[model samples]
Target: MSDYCGGCRYDPKQRVGDHACPYTAGYWSFLARNETEFSGNHRMRQPMQGLHRLTDLDALVDQEKARGSIAP
Candidate 1:
């Protein structure tokens, strides 16, 4: 919950329901920012492969949750 981008440190509420939603931006940015850290990690390699093609955050979260990577 930032004031600019949800993934960034700036999530502006006004940006919330738009195509450029902060959550979306933040989500991608989070991945980009941590790609290297995750790429070689045993737990993230498979899921990381789906990042670029994943547009549904909830679904992605659910998938990861099912894999036991995310906390319930």
Candidate 2:
């Protein structure tokens, strides 16, 4: 781990749950929120497919929405 992540509570590899990194959650949230807009783009094909594979996607979306503008 990098020195910057030594004391951080968030996990960069996690996208859900209490210890999820806000940035990671935010990324998936953005993709979920704009799936239609990005669906036709070739570059987005892989990520969009990956989004569909996330079993906890709905939960992640709800969590991020509940978090709103609050900082984690």
Task: Supply the global lDDT for candidate 1.
Answer: 0.55
Worst 10 residues of 1 by lDDT: 11-20
Top candidate, metric TM-score: 2
lDDT of 1 at 19: 41
Model 2 TM-score is: 0.84
Total clashing pairs in model 1: 8
Candidate number with greatest lDDT: 2
Error of 1 at 55 (Å): 11
Considering only N, C-alpha and C atoms within 3 Å, which residue pairs clash in candidate 1? 2-11, 3-10, 3-11, 3-12, 4-10, 4-11, 5-10, 7-26
lDDT of 2 at 46: 98
Per-residue lDDT over 1-72 for candidate 2, one digit per residue giving the tens place of the 0 to 100 score: 556666889997888889998988999988998999999999999999999999989989989988893234
RMSD of each: 12.2, 3.4
TM-score of every candidate: 0.39, 0.84
